[model samples]
Target chain A: MNQIAETLASEHIHRDEVGAKIGMWLFLFTELILFGGMFLAYAVYRFSYRDYFALASKELDVFIGLINTLILLTSSLTMAMSITALRRGNKKLSLIFLSSTIIFALLFLVNKYFEWSAKFNHGLFPGSNDLLSLPRGEIIYFGLYYVMTGLHAVHVIIGMIILLFMLFYIKSNKVNQDYYIMLENSGLYWHLVDIIWIFLFPLFYLIH
Target chain B: MEHKNNHIVGYGTYIFVWLTLVTLTALTVTVASFDLGGFSIVVALIIASVKALLVMLIFMHLKFDDKIFRIFVAVAFLTLMIFIVLTFSDYSFIR
Candidate 1:
């Protein structure tokens, strides 16, 4: 009877890995809808105010936007490689790649800070007198700009935090080769951040 | 318990996908520079979609993951598309 009880206890502690992954995917679906709504709004404004959007987009520095895109893309690669490394039981390489991913996230945020600061110095922010004096289309353009990119920046920070925790988990063996659903989930979140920026970069900076 | 069949993606594959994504980014920027007018946004979006797909399938492991995940994501994206189309249809005609 004791042996049977022990077996049952072991089974109880065994996780449903597939279920965990499905749950993460469900959460990601919701995130998609959240950002999808904003994309719809942006499309409406851009369609209605084509000329103003074009003019407003010109004010954006595409060079900076391009650089940020590359940063995020490279970060996504590192994040993926980290997961692969972990799966292959190469903890050291996984940690290295994960740390690089976090560094890239920081670099992306730093660039964003400078970009926003430059706009602020120009008084192009939402509700600024300079922005208020602009045409309605331009005003809405910058409004969407702030709301979309601002929200995206928030996600970047969140992704960084998630990856930071993942780094520790990997080191602690809580997320080893045999148990890495958590790390994979984090990778999914990070990739989603990159995917969002892929669209955002073109919509805001390259549309002109 | 770990699934014994868990497909492991190689580092080389990740690097290849990364290279493709970077190249596409450059392509989009170059395409945007030509001032294609209304068509420019369309072209840019198409390129961005390709890049996003590469990340989803390769980086996110969707390609090796269970079929259910692929179906779920497809449904989610379809729903978003429907919402966008319905909204645009309403706005496009009124203006």
Candidate 2:
């Protein structure tokens, strides 16, 4: 009787593990579609006013963009390391790496704030501003600019919140070598966010 | 617990991925600075694709996962690209 009960409990845990993995993948698919729409809009506007887009992109601070790119890329490295730690049964190192990933993500956001505010102060916002004094085409370019990067920033915020939750989960012992799906899934989402910025950096800040 | 497979990610792999990403970023920025005419976007997108592969494979561990999951990811991405391209064609060629 005792052996049967133990077997039943183990089976239940295995079922939950599978469920978590599938659930996370489904959530990731939703994110893919969400970002997919924004990419489509960016492509349309960029193609419509290619020259104006190039001119507007030059106004962006490439230095800040480059810095943010490096920051996010570093965060991704830490995130991957965190997952590796979890899989290897090193809970303390996993938590440390996870904390660093969150810190780097926050740094990325702070840099973005300054970059966006600088543009705002310069009157580069949509719907008529001093920065739009160039031409009508450039004005429309700034509009798309705010919309795309603004949306990307929002995603970064969401990713940060998710990472925070995962961190707490680790601390609470909900995640360990036996079960690290949360870390894996969050890592995937974080990587996607980084990949988006990989494209955004050049699109918004590198045109000559 | 049944350990079906154990695939560890080494530190060298991490460094290699990061190097590839930085190199690609530099290339993209340099290409964008030149007057490549219509080829600029093409080159940018190609570089972005390579970066995406590195992240998906190395960071996300898709390379070590089940084949089914990989197939699903590939199909999803291909479908998304096709949809975007078809929609863009409508706007690009229209009067």
- Strongest candidate by lDDT: 1
- Candidate 1 has a TM-score of 0.95
lDDT of each: 0.91, 0.81
Error of 2 at A131 (Å): 5.4
Pairs of residues at least 3 apart in sequence or in different chains that clash in candidate 1: none
Tens digits of lDDT, candidate 1, A36-138: 9999999998999999998998889999999999999999999999988998879999999999999999999999999999999999888999999999999
* Each candidate: RMSD: 3.2, 3.1
Docking class of 1: high
Question: How many clashes would you count in candidate 2?
Answer: 1
TM-score for the first chain in candidate 2 comes to: 0.88
Q: How close is chain B to the truth by TM-score, in each candidate?
A: 0.94, 0.86
Best by TM-score: 1
By summed lDDT, the worst window of 10 consecutive residues in model 2 chain A runs over: A13-22
Collision pairs in model 2:
A123-A131
DockQ of candidate 2, scored on C-alphas against the true complex (2 decimals): 0.58
Across all models, the iRMS values in order are 1.2, 2.0
